[model samples]
Target: MSGDDKYILVAQIGGAFGVKGEVKITAYTADAQALKAYSPLLDAKGQPALTIISARPDKHGLVAKVKELATKEEADAARGRKLYIHRDQLPEPDEDEFYLTDLVGLEGRDADDKVIGKVKSVQNFGADDMLEITPAEGGPTWYLPFTKAATPEIKPAEGWLRIIRPVETSERDAD
Candidate 1:
């Protein structure tokens, strides 16, 4: 994978917190405070962007002071900018645990080995996670519920996953 693709988005700048350069941050890490530990955050292009000078838990998320950002306007301008870190910098996940980014591009298959599509993205719209799949046959993309019953297998090394779709029930069928 390319270096840019090897980075994981860990947080986003919410907005300026105070008159100083401190900005509000919404961290995506397991521990919100751990954002300080992952210093020298990079942008999407993999260039060193923001350095966390100090960070503290806030009512909204976490307030952070960035190096060189000395005014509220400077920090406010950075709002919505995402912070990423190289995947190699992160500790590996334990067995049965996998990063969501790792799931992208894996082939979607069926129990009988039928090619469904490739995983486009994993998203959560205020509900359970959903796997967006691009049809291998060149059709519109669809989402499959990211549940054990829906996706029976996830073999990333093998470059594929087995999906067992839930049965559809109509009123007539139910009768």
Candidate 2:
């Protein structure tokens, strides 16, 4: 296992929120406030990065005070840092539910049970999460909606997922 895999990403530090060094952050956990429970999150290199002293929900995300980031300059400098918690600190997903991080590397199979792609990573753009699958055919990676309708079966322990590939048709196709 890699050092990077030893931790699960939980949040990302945004730019400084105020002149006081309080910064805005996007929390990936089910409860943003729950981030405090896993204080002193780590950076990519597995070094202590953020020790959140206090946090409150804001219109954008959470405004937080970090133990080490005491000044706005320090906070701004840390912007875009991804925060992680030791893997053991996170709870295993309850049956049928899985963490996005856990989904990485799962094989992507089609309805026919044929290899199609590999689960690359999870991405969220303010809406529901999406899976980036690296196509088995070796072209550009594609995005699949991480919904039961699209990815009906996800067997992380089994190391694979069943995807209902979407087929798009247009009026030209009807001609």
Candidate 3:
């Protein structure tokens, strides 16, 4: 697959651990320990990038030894690098279930079934997933909370995203 092929965010490198090459990692996988199973994790460019030789659970995350890293300084230098897996590496989603990566490129439609935009990407800035939409009429993109109410229906198989307009809130509304 090309570098632009879909890649799923699985984990992120944290600070170095101990004096060895081991580094702490924050895994986004459902089973944290399962991170090692996805060997040779890919980087943003879709290249085989990392291998976890071993890992142990820590209070904050996982302390992992990387195959390519042999010193604390090496691990520290790799901190903040995101780890991913090719989309094809994942098992098929169960019925009515979908990976966030599947949301990209789907049509974003309003409640009235009008094409408002296209899904550019799915993002999470620590709170929750947000859908980045490229407007159909060609303006700067905007983000919509990927909540059940805001995106009530998302049929990835059918290339559709049903959007419900969010209620406008003001400072007064928070009073």
Candidate 4:
């Protein structure tokens, strides 16, 4: 299949865990445990698929065993390799929610409907999500919070998001 028809990356093998061929899987899913149900994962080349034999929480990731991998050395060898699932395997998001991948390339406009830039990427730093927008004029990127106040409108079908700039107020003198 072409790259466009391939899978979306969701996880990666961290390293070997125990002597039982269990490998550490760092899941990129919002709910790490839910990743098991989204298997079997495809490799980067779109071949050598792997299924989750078992999965459980370990530190910040999930400890899992891939089907047919029966040795610690074999599991370790797959460390650092990314895991992908076919796009069709993923469920559709609920209303008002969107996947990070779906937001990339969408245009960004100000409250007045003037185009500011295009979304280069969506980032999360544990607190809140951020939108990395590349200006149309080719200046430095802008990192804006993906909050309702900052982003009031997100019309995915239109391939754009409307952002509202925060108002600055001057401090008044004491009465």
Q: Give the best candidate by lDDT.
A: 3
CA RMSD, predictions in order: 2.5, 2.6, 3.0, 4.3
Clashing pairs in 1: none
Query: Could you tell me the lDDT of residue 63 within candidate 3?
Result: 93
Runs with alpha carbons beyond 4 Å of true place in candidate 1: 1-5, 167-175
lDDT of 4: 0.82
Q: How does residue 123 of candidate 2 score in lDDT?
A: 90
Per-model lDDT: 0.85, 0.86, 0.87, 0.82
Worst 10 residues of 2 by lDDT: 1-10
Q: What TM-score goes with each of the models?
A: 0.89, 0.84, 0.90, 0.78
Q: How far is candidate 3 from the true structure (C-alpha RMSD, Å)?
A: 3.0
Worst 10-residue lDDT window for candidate 1 reads 1-10
Residue pairs with clashing backbones, model 3:
none
Runs in model 4 with CA error above 4 Å? 59-61, 165-175
Candidate 3 weakest ten by summed lDDT? 163-172
> Tens digits of per-residue lDDT for model 3 on 1-175?
4546778889988878999778998888887887788888888888777898988997656898888888999998999999988778888999999988899999999978999999999898989999999999999998999999899998999999898767667855986
Better of 3 and 4 by lDDT: 3
Candidate 1 to truth, TM: 0.89
